[model samples]
Target: MNPEIYSLFDEPHADNEYTYRHNIGVGIIATYLGMKLGLSKENLSALTLAAMLHDVGKTRISDNIVEKPGKLNEAEYEDMKRHAIYGYELLKNIPGIPPSIALTALQHHEREDGQGYPQGKSGKDINLHAKIVAIADVFHAMSSSSGYAVL
Candidate 1:
């Protein structure tokens, strides 16, 4: 794992072990997808970094908000939507970070049909790396009990 990614996991605010593990799972899935797509080493690295830190901005949210046992109100949902931009802000200044990684923070919420958050970007408007990360993120979140548990 990249040192930067490891440092993200070590953050005090990232105490939700479920989210951290989910992020790592997404990164691993994205990495494999990138390799299968025949992405260059540099591209693979960038995608991996993007997947790893995709949820880093969640650190700014309170544990109560992230760990709510029930559904969130509209206001709370709006706050949750800001995490992607917050993630971009957190990763943008890191030295040696690829633009693709930062872009993932902005574009990962986008959907193929344009039914997503932050930006309602659709189809090719989103980068390939971001798309891959988004798919992996949703996959992990849906499959993990602590992520999107359907009660």
Candidate 2:
């Protein structure tokens, strides 16, 4: 891995271990799924990177919101959702970060049914990498033992 990329995964975060592990797990699973779906090598690499950093915006969230143990109230839930936009802003201008990678952060929360957040973009409007990450993110959260309040 390039040092620049390594530094991204290595960046210190005040969040708990579960969030880190979830990112790793989602990266692996999303890459595997993408490969099975016949994504090219370049796309697979992008998918892995994007999926791993899908929740990178969470680092910018308040500890109280990010680490909240139980269900969040309406206001907090709305606040928690901003992590997607925050993640996009954080990665969009990085020298080596591709547009797709930055976009994955912004669109991963969007859904096929057009009921997603931030932009509420539907189906084709959301990037493919983001869609894959969304699936992987949810899968990792649901499969893990940790109590993820939301994805």
Candidate 3:
């Protein structure tokens, strides 16, 4: 993780609008995707914000595991999966951010088949922002050469 990303998790007072700093491609793709989906400008902003900060909970994870070069052990994987909930916990109380934004962080890992972590909310239970973020996150990860790419 970048030192700045670490500060994002460690420093609560730091800026939360980290899309421009962390994943500009994801932001652009998410916005474009949202526009394609016919989302309004206000909805687009919410979608962009949710996509950018979706992984902010990674700060709660251990650096040793986060920076590990090899694939993680089962325990490490499980621990890392808690980032979704950590992100929700981190953002839920912030005064300015929307509740949907926090839900986006919480449910981005959730799947339609109830296979996702933290919660198994399937189908309609999942929020739209989370579903959009999931798609954008996957698109960015696969297209980029970063270590996060799994497919």
Candidate 4:
């Protein structure tokens, strides 16, 4: 993991605190897991960066929707699901970022069982880095301390 890339969110922004903490946790966990899985240095770096910014699109979401204390209404849930594609669109054209990183952001919510959002990719169709980020994201979101906890 590149220190500078990770350091980008080191100074918390008051409004983005939830996003900052959640993405940081996902990044740390994904980096450790990537190392454990023997990913190459370059792959691990991409994974770390992708994990850190996987939810960058959430910044575009209305705070009322993102910070809702209870369940999102049906329409809000559908709107929220667009974050993956929004993140992908935000990242795809950026110079220097690996294509895998952008793909990871696009596909992180895709499930192995074909029950996910945006593209509904499943099984081998999903990128490896995206799968890793998805697991890490869920782990962080489900942790008791995370404000995004659903269960």
lDDT values of the candidates?
0.79, 0.83, 0.72, 0.78
Which digits, one per residue and each the tens of the lDDT, describe model 3 over residues 26-85? 667878888999998888987887777777777788777765667999999888888889
Tens-digit per-residue lDDT, 1-151, candidate 4: 3344443344323366776777778999999999999999988988888888787766567778877887898999988887788778877877766887778878999999998878888999999999999999888888836457521
Per-candidate TM-score against the hidden true structure: 0.88, 0.92, 0.82, 0.87
Q: Which of the predicted structures, 1 or 2, would earn the higher TM-score when compared with the native?
A: 2
How well is each residue in 1-151 modelled by candidate 1, as lDDT tens digits?
A: 3356557655524566776687789999999999999999988988888888887777777777778877988888888778888888887777777888778987888889999878899998888998999889888878777647311
Between candidates 1 and 3, the lDDT winner: 1
Alpha-carbon deviation at 26 in model 3, angstroms: 2.2
Worst 10 residues of 1 by lDDT: 5-14
Off by over 4 Å in 1: 1-6, 147-151
Question: Per-prediction count of colliding residue pairs?
Answer: 0, 0, 0, 0
lDDT of 2 by residue, 5-102 (tens): 55667542524677778878899999999999999998899899998888888878888887778888999888889999998997888876668888
Best by lDDT: 2
CA lDDT, candidate 3, residue 92: 81
- Candidate 3 lDDT (Cα, whole model)? 0.72
Error of 2 at 40 (Å): 1.0
- Sort order, lDDT high to low: 2, 1, 4, 3
What is the Å distance of residue 118 in model 2 from its true position? 0.9
Cα deviation of 79, candidate 1, in Å: 0.3
